[model samples]
Target: MEIKLEEKKIKLVLIILFLGMILPIFLTHQNFKIYDSITKALELWDKEHLLIGMLKLVIMNTLRSIPMYIAIFLLFDSIEIIKNGRKRNFEKVLLILPIIPIAYSLIKIFYDIQLPVGKTSILGVLWFCYYVKFDLKNITYVEKYLVFLSFIVGLQWLDVSRFFNFLGVGEITSDLNKAIIFMEADVIVTLICISFFSFFTLFSILLLHFFKGQEERIARSRSEMENRHLKEVQLLVHDLKTPIFSVGALLETLTLQEEDERKKLYLKKMEDSIEKTNVMISEILSVKSEKPIVIEEMMRFIFSFLSVHKNIEGITYKSYLKKDYKLKGNRILLSRVIINLIVNSWEANSSVVNIMVKDYKKRLIIQIDDCGDGIDIDNINELIKEGVSTKNSSGKGLSFVVKTIKEMEGKIYFVKKIKNGTKIYIILKGDEYGE
Candidate 1:
């Protein structure tokens, strides 16, 4: 399946490049008035100042190629959207599109173009080679820019067209002979420049590729290390369950033996707390499959769990649950998610946390509001990313919540609050499961 997806991506990219390459040819097929005006303007500049004429030529060609650049950008961006099923920032395409025309102009400035090979053809070849070798979408922005710069410099300095033209054995016209003679004196200089730039560009690409590989390797190593640590922690938690089970059994024995009413009530509460701890430990150790659960029942368990286990001093909780709904998900995991959010609010020094649930027939809406040092509105999106946290702790709670919600085909949003607090809204597909 993965290989087939990759093949599809490759075919899409090739089609985009083919269209980009052919677009310039189609646009310049006929001699238009604008082309003639630009050519006459460049001629006028050439007669006055040679340097200015060359600069204008570069700029004019770049301007002419803007349509082709826009086409390529749209094609590439459309392909990305189709393949990834997500919208990307248009600014990224805009940022890279101008580089194509500028690079083509630079090549024209540095190399002498011969007949039978139009400037657009050379541009096509350069684009084809660069994109075929490196996928622009997959690389980092810095790497993309550097690799493109190296590609332009390498092709410009190679002057492959001149070398091929010089080696042609076909009958040459007098004009061609004269052009060869004119460039004859600079043969040695051209050869040296080609050799130096080719080697430099090749080395630069290799060095950059090596550094990219090293970075990927380091990232993979860190991931493996984290996985190993997580396994160790899981094992420790499993070991703790044995002692927890023993404590629950002892509490049960004491609760049954107590004769005093008040003391028996206290002992019963301790037993209940110990049993809840055992259930939590079991949840941590066992993976629960998705099942139909009553939303009201789950909320009741969550509220009771938080009130008993996480009743931090000076912190309060308020719930406004209006209707019952049936949701298809792991009940324990969902409970853990709400419990984690409330605990986070408590840790944030919230005086009060409010949880509101509303039923919308075929959907369920849950809103959690907290009166605490509010979350950074600007970094709300970043907060859900793994290893990202506003507080000084290992940032995994919200990440876990996000993953769990996604698994259940639900959406979570952090809405900006006008007052001194944070508002979180969650939407899930469900049905009314009456009282």
Candidate 2:
């Protein structure tokens, strides 16, 4: 609702703030002071006070550069969030976000026009954190190279002087130099050094950014490969888990028929071991399961499954929904989550299992109600994390449940109920079900 909309608006404002910071310097470089866009820009520079004027230039330039890195960094970090109607990649999305005040700043700085910016932004803070997290090592490498580049720039500045015309652009002519009263050798030489340094500084920033991007790309590729390997392992585990359960059942049948008492005991132990092995297999398969089916029929299939596997002992199960609900996701994975939740409830001495469903625009809000000794308040969040277990068996099953919900972009939270039962709410987004 309004809160979500406001959050998006806030992020948009921050983006503009960051974009504005870098716009001036980039535009200045590109425009070459032809003096068109922001003609008032030079007003900020006091020529009579050269120190103030130089400070104005440096401050404005750095302000503009910081946000450029931030916008670029966030663009990469959130590349996968393709929401609403935009399916654009990170680069395309950033391109759509405004250009680095390129042509406009160039025209303005040359004409001394100031570009007015609106509002404050945290892009400076955002980029500082990001650089420290991911780019510092690479930036240091670039800085080390920049030290050598500085010397080279100084030598090149010399070549553009006297008879050593490396760039032959413009050197002091004797007649023009004599006409300028303030043009002392010291002042002119200082200006040349400043300009030379500025050029090298900007060049180094761009080079560092480019290398940082390369490092990120390499990191992502390595991550994707690791996920691929994990998925392969998961599939292999799935193949192994299903048959172990069947083998366990076969062993149970043999145990009942065995005449020797010792042999029967051994058969029972084998059956128990097979069952334990099967659970482990399930845990492994849970790691890499794919998207769930969202059809109404599939949800029905899941309810029917619970009915078929209804506890023959002291446990009881109930389907509380009035009508069928539809969700897009892997039915198998969803079923596993449901089974684990129900098993946990049963273990907590709950005889009744209530599955309630409600329509939430495009989403289906499902709540599983269990009258049991609810989750430990302190450990609720931890239970969802990997390797966290509240049960006697391997903790992977509960971790898998949390992982599955996250994969679907859904959320799960433990609710404090007036009644003694625990309420676990699962919110599955409508858009995800379609996809």
Candidate 3:
């Protein structure tokens, strides 16, 4: 099923992807070979010692692998159903099925059970192909972590970590006289296999997430700098406009005062030259002169403007300013955002673009909806990125939307329907709601 990639459901998918990649090898680690490896490695090669090490590996492997594998399948299927956007009951019902795998894993780990009679490598490989092609990586976190897990586990050589007795409990000891299930595998071998896959699985997730966050942060900082640069260029152009306009104005005055037709024409020519310069400056300045402020004032101005625009009579803009939520943007910059959205909506053939404030749970939500040609199928997200534009814009409107929202310490995204227009959703932290 096509699970829409939303932020909330990321963790579940990541867990599944991780397990699908790592579990088979992980569970197999605790199989019979470990008993031989440890017994041989330690020179305690007799049956008693072999059984002891093998049993320990089996128990520990079961403890880590069972619950983990169960978690993997449960979360994976839940995410699958959610991705499909299917009937809720089946998703809900299927959610609990993870418990059985979890129970199996846990019971094997913590309780005394004969190791199941199958080679675990087959299980590992089966789960591999299951997730490999599923490719549910439209989500960022999933894409980042799953790829990392698959790569690390692929070599099958970097197996790491062994003991996990954090439960503070020892394994249940079998009586000395009892023969364990037609034991084929050794303890140390199983432990090594389990340790390799299990450690790689667990550790790789933590590592990938940590790095992805850092990379995102760095990317964000780079983006913010670019916006600041845009603003800076605007400042430089705005600074230049006054002198250019002054020169053009002086030339215009000369043309009005001149009695000689030739001189009048020449003065008019100079006026035209500098006038173009002034126009370019204005467009440049129009985007650059920005500061930061609270959200309400901006909405108030936009809605107030929309209330009067004769061309926009059929369209309505609404505001939902929360009493306590505040944003880190100033009036001028925020006003520009409202104006741009309104204009873009109108341009896109939408009779109306709804602009409203909402309590997006703990965060503040500023939503812009328009019944226009929804965003271009391919470039909705592209537009928010720097240097991407449909109109060959100063290429700044939506980028401005993104920049301003971020300056306000918020985020903005477009949910565009394939046929209709788009919904621009911005979530901002105010008093960091539910903080």
- Per candidate, the number of residue pairs that clash is 0, 24, 31
The alpha-carbon RMSD values of the candidates against the true structure, listed in the order shown, are: 11.4, 12.1, 11.5
> Which should have the higher lDDT, number 2 or number 3?
3
Which has the greatest TM-score?
1
For 72-135, candidate 1 gives per-residue lDDT tens digits of 4334544432223234434334444554545445434544222233333354344534443433
Ten consecutive residues with minimal summed lDDT in candidate 2?
Answer: 116-125
lDDT order of candidates, top first: 1, 3, 2
Error at 41, model 1, angstroms:
25
lDDT of 1: 0.57
Q: What is the lDDT of every predicted structure here?
A: 0.57, 0.53, 0.54
Local distance difference test, candidate 2: 0.53
How far does residue 298 in candidate 1 sit from its true spot (Å)? 2.3
TM-score winner between 1 and 2, please give it: 1
* Off by more than 4 A, model 1: 1-144, 155-223, 288-294, 309-330, 357-365, 380-396, 402-411, 427-435
Tell me the deviation in Å of residue 141 in model 2.
Answer: 18
What would the per-residue lDDT of candidate 3 be over residues 1-435, giving only the tens digit for each residue?
434333333566556445533444444544545535543534543445644554555454454444344444335543434332233434433454444344445455654443332223224434444443334323454544454444335223222222222312222212211223223333544455566566656665565556556667777888899789878888888788778877877887787888999998777766755764564456456644433445665565455555446556665555455554554435556666767887887778888666677665566676788888888644555677767777767777888888787766666677786668888777766434322
